[model samples]
Target: MKGRKFSPQKKDRRKAIRSIVEGIVLLTILIVIIRALLPSRGYFPVSEDRNLQTEQGFIAVSYFGVDRTGNKTLISTKRLEEHLKALTASGYVTISQQDIINYYTAGRPLPKKALFLIFEDGRRDTGIFAQKIMEKYNMKATILTYAQNLTLEDSKFLKAKDLKELEKSTFWEFGTNGYRLSYINVFDRHDNFLNQLNTYKFQLVSGYLDRNYNHYLMDYIRDASGIPMETYSQMQERIGWDYNSIEDIYKRELGKVPDMYILMHSNTGQFGSNDKVSAENFKWMQKLFQMNFNREGDSLNTSQASIYDLTRMQPQSYWYTNHLLMRIQDDTGEEVAFVTGDEDRNNSWDTLKGQPEFIKDTIALTSLPGESGLIKLKKNITDSNIEVSVELDGNKAGIQTIYVRADDELEEYLALSIENNVLYVYEKHKGGEKKTIFSLNLELHDGIKPQSLEENKLEAEIKELETELKYVSDVELTKRLNEQLKEKKARRAASVIEGAKEYIPEIGISEAGKRFLKVMLENDEISVIIDNKAVTERLKVSVTEGKGVYLEAAPSKEGYSQRNLTDDVYDGVFKSLVISRYSTEKKDDILYDNRLAGFEKVADTIQKGWDSLINWFIKYL
Candidate 1:
């Protein structure tokens, strides 16, 4: 009828069990305390594998030409091929600027080793070289042009036809470095500046400057008196004028306007112009797209917007010969370095006083009339085939028979023959055995029809998002949403092409459009025609993910170094990354010591010990 009286031994056993339980509790608390004491990873996960691929910063390398011997900007063709071979072998994936922008804006994941390759100055040779190399490597590159170099009359520079051809490759996209800004006199005089602005804008509107000028607008902000003349608002007016001009030109020529403007030549807001104007100009440009710095510490927002400046790093010296790797430290403290190629060493252009010795010739290529140039194609039949004519300018060494084929159709035809400087691609009633040829002309506008009904819905949704984003209190969310909207708008803009993808007879054709097709077919080698599909398939495989980090660098030991990055330390770095070219200050201060510190090192050791103890106990039991 009562609780049994416990023996002294039983009482001791109860006490021991209680002691053991207390000890376990203390041990667990101690473990937690130790974990807390270890260095924090901040946003990064303890497991390295858990790190998002997007968190890692990537590199965009500018190229001029491969094997352009003696040209300062040229990387030897052999060296370039070797570099690509190494990059592919080391798991690097070539991506577009759109892909990079999308990743930050939309939280899109990128391949483990993303790279952006840009070719500057719009040289036809460079386009051709890029085509060959890009096809070989299944890589994509941004072909940045200057307005002065883009006339249909130019043979030295890439013309509209060349651009159209290059764009058809699926590996090339067109971006403008500057309009006639490169060719105009951006003097400190007000008249000069005004003239420069009007000229470039007029050039864009008048002719084949089809793409939006993505690079920064370089202007001489100071007056002839060597004083900063323009007030902040005046500077804004001038810069805004330039922006509006370019926008208008793009709208008139390409049927759409550009929301994004890359700062050209300098990183700081006041590069080539007054800092106030430069910063304000960038800010105004952002506002045009309904974006701005409404939040602090938001690197991806307009607060961090800057001119995307690239430099050779070494001035007066042939830096391109040395293999260089330019590293960027992102806001998240992850570091990424792109293999910028042989000329990027030491960022010579950053230190050079005068024009670099490598840039021997800065003259704009003479423009040739596109409509009346070397060749022309008339749309005899809508969207099916065109009549080709060649008006050779005394240089007609290679004259051969012409052939035509549709993209979706397999059958090829002996389209025409060349005599004197003329090409006869008219109807041939009587024909003999002829060669069959595949043409990119047929695929010129494939799938890229005018904005579809769905695009209209997307535009409406984007407008709604824009209104919501304008008043949204959460800055971060606003930015993400804003980026999504920008991306959507870009997609929609892309859909508003003047011509359809693949020959659509429904859309009326133009002589300029026909000529684009003719030039591409003429320029393409037989191998390129056959290998187009295979190259596209290979591009998919070229971007596969792999375990661990991959570092790509050249053999020059002087050009390579490591750096540690932190979130707070990387804000300026991020700004610098976006707008400015490479500088020694950035290399030494920003890019040095970019390693991420997290809980991984400490936690893993403890986890292993705990597991080992448990396993030992199980075995003994």
Candidate 2:
């Protein structure tokens, strides 16, 4: 049977429709191919800004890692974007290794605000998550890799091929952390000797290896007794071997090693914990690389800084954008435009004292060295029994208090204070009388059992003794340390909690991590839960009629270090604060929730997409 023939007009219409569909598909493919082939051209607003000065020196900032979802150490993509956007908006531009070298060596000028951005550890996740942001901002960064990962088949770390591809992307340049990351002469808090541990083994037993653990090159080759076994020349050779290996691997894999090198373990009196070993490491570093990040915390680098000894600040994942700015300004003595993550979220709260800024999904109630910052959630509720569920930054440095049933005058409230790993249940009213209803030292108190506390004390004692014994050269002090260590060891061995499995933290509250906080106020009684475990079964509180949720951050007298240092500010950040009155009125106030309602979110996303589409068509159509 002959196929039915369409009229010429009908065929033309069908052909035109088919051609349009083909054209769209081809256009999309062409755009993608062009994007892949195009070389990235970084936009330096700082250089373009004639009003800004370029005579000032550059500063380096390093991030440990980045991932889709952030952790205590690794930053999330969203936060990374915020950080980069803020820097770019403030007329800061990323500088390359050559740019820095030129600035120092040739007396060439830098941008008004030059940023030598870095992402250390050569993590695949860091590359995956951070690359888009770098591209988005037209920024460039040096991605540090471990030369040891070159030989290994591990996919967790970025391989040499990955590094080369990253270089091709123009957003990334290659650098080396070291040949390997290892520890030596290590005594854990439990007084267990961990001799020469690799990265995997080190992580497996990381909780124990706190202050006692030393960087592999930080000390001479030591025996189990923590005595240096290596001679001066032998120590030099051992240190040189790792550096040589790093050079060899990079040269073999990626043609030549990148110029930048971040020596592991900072805050060691300029370079290394061991002076002689540091001298050797410094010699090797200078010979191998043009620059070395010899220190962390201080990000500023000037012409006066030694090429072999540079510094950069590694921003922890917990840092608010303002916190980052505070640190940078403190370091460089330059005024920085402090960033408030999302100002629109502030409409729900009243800042009672100090500064309260919204930072992404959290509210940073930041305070100065000796100041207290407080903010109240603006919602009217009459329920006496209400629950405040929050995820706190939970720092050991400052006090993070959850005030429930707070009066409008801010005179009376039931406060659950988390300070220096201790939970203080107290009441505040208009009168001068301040009553402590309950107090539990979270460091001593365990969710499982209290026996673990004694065991921890013994281990901590042993750890202290070991540390003293290692540091003290005096015969008398060493003997005393040994005796104390022996007694602690005996106690630990005799303790019944030795074999018990526990996840007891070194510090109950961490400055770098988030802890779940839930406080339930019931008439005259209040209950507290931290990290989903009951902190107190029953905490008696004064009867409060009003249902006002408040947050406070005060300068901690204890817990974090450098207490004597003046002008030190602490920010107590809290995320996802929700107050629910379950029984009576069922009133719920998501005071600081950053998320929109489901339908609203859908509409927002559609609007954004539509705007983007329209803008793109307008630009290129």
Candidate 3:
């Protein structure tokens, strides 16, 4: 066969491409090796004279975990960095377990603004995502582990080897989340008794297990009838076995058990859910460790705290840095510093009411109890046809609103509100009648389909009932649970509702992520999209001219908390507000409110194939 001939230009191009690939590969390998050998303690500097006296005590804050892409509870590395930067700027220094013990037991002085940071769950991703951030901030954090996880070969959780390396890195300290995370004395939402479940089983059936389940160490082992399955002596023996197992795992894996212990669950009565369990856990923890974090949700630990009894506030993934500062100030009862990010962005927003602080890349509009916080962009959208794009990052309990084409006083305007996972569009006329243009129930959003949602829920229920029925030797309970399983399994077939689901677009506007929202006002018609999905085609609007964009946030009717210093205070967080004039008649439809993801996916596939072809040459040539 004759060889295909290439022009001089094509041959030169090929040679250049090959040279670039080889250089990139060699550079990548070199960078990896250099990074491995580098000793990166931390970038945020700590002084040698570390003893600064203060009687105000220290704030202990913990996170569930960190991940590159976060989940419902785990925080993303981007958020963690912002929080650490804010804390560092506010003069908060990270304290170690030894530092905490010295402050509580030896009556030693801690830094005026000290923080005991912790990352729970001991997830491999948590260590991977948080490592660079910790190094960048020069911060120290304790990693809490499940002792049983050390024995498992699952790569989801960190192994003993990873922990040993982390210890060597000097950025991490180890602790225990008891022997494991399991639930006992469990009851489903339907009041179905599911006696006991391991962590894996609990995750497999968590949709059936709401807030009614108890920690394995919290309550006495209960049978299906909710009676104590084991006597007092037997209960103690069972719990002691957990403690012994934890000790044994630590000894086997890391030569000795760590001194830090965070209790398995929340208990207001000193340690466990109740007095008996609390006492048992307290005694065992004291016998095994030097310090125990006995509570969550409140961060302040004073000199009066027992060395064996400490507490840390677990920061939810939804929390802003201000929320943490607000909590710490309240718990410590001290005036604290806050992070005010991007003065230019802050200057652009004018507060109508309440405190509005520009934090990181978002404008944090925090409202006081019983009142609403409102802010408006200084610039007005004068064009009759305009588009507004923003991201709403607020809690489930608050009402966060984006107002477009509103009066300067906001008496008459168009409001798009996200209240308790529902989207509402309203037309307001001050002294006259207010009208609801349309309200959309945001039950299922982007990245989730209606069928997938129902299927997942049903699968969880079936799994729960099946697991329960498998172990239940009781005839009546087993029969009842089996019937429930059958009913759940029957629901696997997706049903069609003849209503407006077709009209409703899959908009991801839930509390899980920073929900992206874009609205278009063409004359008197309003078209809306949320989280890059088309939500509404066109809705009629009464008022539609002259006014600018306004952001308002307030505690929902059910969201108010009586506590003095809590993040329950609503922060109407907004970022990436882009308001511009739009002409539908003249311009081609450029908005990807419907199929942006599809376009990106196709483009990415082509780019990856081209790169793979280049890699083939790099390998075979």
- Give the number of the best model, judged by lDDT: 3
**Residue pairs with backbone atoms closer than 3 Å in model 2 (clashes):** none
TM-score of 3: 0.77
CA lDDT of every candidate = 0.37, 0.73, 0.74
- Model 1, 491-610: lDDT tens per residue? 743243544232222211111111111221111221111112221111111111111111111111111111110111100000001001122133111211112225744675676676
Give lDDT: candidate 3, residue 223.
Answer: 81
Model 1 quality (TM-score) = 0.36
lDDT of 3 by residue, 1-621 (tens): 999886999989999999999899767655654453355664343563675865778888899898644666789766888788878877889888888878777887887788889999999878877888788778888998999999988888998999998888888899989888888888765566767788767776764555667888887888878788898888889999999999999999999898999887754647766678778888898799999887776788877777777778877776666666666666777765666566766677786775677744467887653567788778666676877778887766678898887887777888899887788899888787667878876766554444433444555567877766655788988888878777777764443352222222222222343578888889889899987888897788778675677888886655422111234456787765667667666533332121224665588578667555544543344
For candidate 2, write residues 13-63 as lDDT tens digits: 999999999889668656743553345564433454443333568889999
Best by TM-score: 3
Candidate 3 overall Cα lDDT vs. reference? 0.74
Task: Show the lowest summed lDDT stretch of 10 residues, model 3.
Answer: 500-509
Candidate 2 or 1, higher TM-score:
2
